[model samples]
Target chain A: EAAVTQSPRNKVTVTGGNVTLSCRQTNSHNYMYWYRQDTGHGLRLIHYSYGAGNLQIGDVPDGYKATRTTQEDFFLLLELASPSQTSLYFCASSDAGLANTGQLYFGEGSKLTVL
Target chain B: GDQVEQSPSALSLHEGTGSALRCNFTTTMRAVQWFRKNSRGSLINLFYLASGTKENGRLKSAFDSKERYSTLHIRDAQLEDSGTYFCAAATGGYKVVFGSGTRLLVSP
Candidate 1:
């Protein structure tokens, strides 16, 4: 089974503070993604990585930066945390590209609160 | 622009009842996926269809690429099935666009 894990399940930070959320996947998937979920909105992709050092921008990449240091680890960085950035963050992984057989396995999610 | 639109922003169903959820796509999609988010915020993958219909357990899902829509039918709904269900579509690339989601409440 594909396993994805996230660190700092719950985080609280003051405005302008720097925050980092970490994710690790044991499936050795080639693709990793970061998304944020709001109350009435669907999950919005913030950033994605194709491999250990390749990153791609997603729909909502502003105020967020991502780094894939290893095949198993992906990180989301918020340089200046704002209240608008407060949301439930999820990390997902897929075996390869987006194909019919490629299903995304998500982490439990990290709840970040910016005060 | 929203690439995916889901119907019945919210739904309430009694236990053992059946209901269906729909998702309309803005453009042709290569594949569609269905997911159920539990109360604990875990997203469980229900189905991933490139085309045609797929049945598993009491759930059935269909994806029509030409019509740009998909449907998920729940049979004999159970209380444990209460959660937010989302439909996502993968268009021409590796990125998948997700619908706003439908909040389902299965009451006894």
Candidate 2:
């Protein structure tokens, strides 16, 4: 099974605070994604990376930014956090390229609270 | 606009009963995936299908890209089967969209 580990399983911050969430996948998958799960919205993609130094915008990328520093590392940053940005974030990795696609393996999730 | 619409938002079944969850897509999708959120809050991949059907144990899933839909059938529901199920569809570019999810409760 593929392993994707996330740091700071839980976090709390005040408005305008800076927050960074970290994710590392050991499987060397070429694709990594960040998604947020809210009550009525379900899971919406925030950002994705095809490889190191490559980032793609997702549907809900308003208050967040992401970077892929290495093939195994992906990070999400919130520069001026607001209460509405508080959500459950998940990191997933896959080796999807063309016809050869794989299932997404997700991290345990990080719950953030902005007051 | 939401690309994937999954129903019934909630489900209840007896231990030996069965049911099916369906997802309707507004446009053609390249592939579909089903996942169950386990008690530990991990999203467990149940099935991934570009087309046709795949069965594992008492659970089976089918995807019809041309028809713009997918179905997940669960037979002989067990207590452990109770969880929130989500269906996601991808239309290439590695962008996957998820449905609202169905919460299933199996009781004895």
Candidate 3:
């Protein structure tokens, strides 16, 4: 099984504040993703990276920025945060190939509150 | 519009009973993955199906790409099984969509 860890299990910030959520995976997977879960919305992808120095926009990439410093590290940055950005954020890693059938290993999630 | 729709948004079951959760995709998905969110809010991977069925302990999952649907069956429910179950589908090589999730409450 792959191991994924997230920092700052909980966070609180005021509107227009800056926040960053970090994730590290030990599996050396090439694909990393950032998603936010909210009531009635399930999980919405914010950003993803195929490898270091590579990035891709996802379903809900607005108000978010991400960087894949290395294969094991991915960061999601929320600049000028708003109340709508308050939710549970999760980071995941996958090793899917051309078929894209691989399962994702997820972190424990980080809860952020915007005041 | 590509979407994953899950049924029975919430469910309650008694210990020793069983139930099934279903996810239907609006478009052709390459694969489907099932996850369970534990009490502490950690999402645990349950199963990943590309075409057929797979079982682990009291949990079983099946994916029928032709029908654009997948099913997760839980047998002999236990208190530890109470949480939210989410199904996500992989499509267009890189796009993954998640369902609204089904919250299960197992009571003694």
Model 1 agreement with the true structure over A40-106: per-residue lDDT tens digits: 8999999999899999999999999999999999999999999999999999999855555577889
Candidate 2 regions off by >4 Å? A97-100
- Models 1 onward score TM values of 0.96, 0.94, 0.96
User: Per-residue lDDT of B12-98 in model 1, one digit per residue for the tens?
Assistant: 999999999999998888888899999998889899898999999999999999998999999999999999999988875568889
Clashes of 1: 0
Q: Residues A12-113, candidate 3, lDDT per residue (tens digit)?
A: 999999999999999989999999998776799899999999999998999999999999999999989999999999999888632466678899999999
Q: What is the TM-score of chain A alone in each candidate?
A: 0.97, 0.95, 0.95
Predictions in order: lDDT: 0.92, 0.90, 0.91
After superposition on all C-alphas, the RMSD of every candidate to the true structure, in Å, is: 1.2, 1.6, 1.2
Question: Judged by DockQ cut-offs, is candidate 3 incorrect, acceptable, medium or high?
Answer: medium
**DockQ for each candidate?**
0.64, 0.53, 0.62
Model 3: how far is B73 from its true place, Å? Answer: 0.7
Number of the top candidate by DockQ? Answer: 1
Q: Model 3: how far is B37 from its true place, Å? A: 0.7
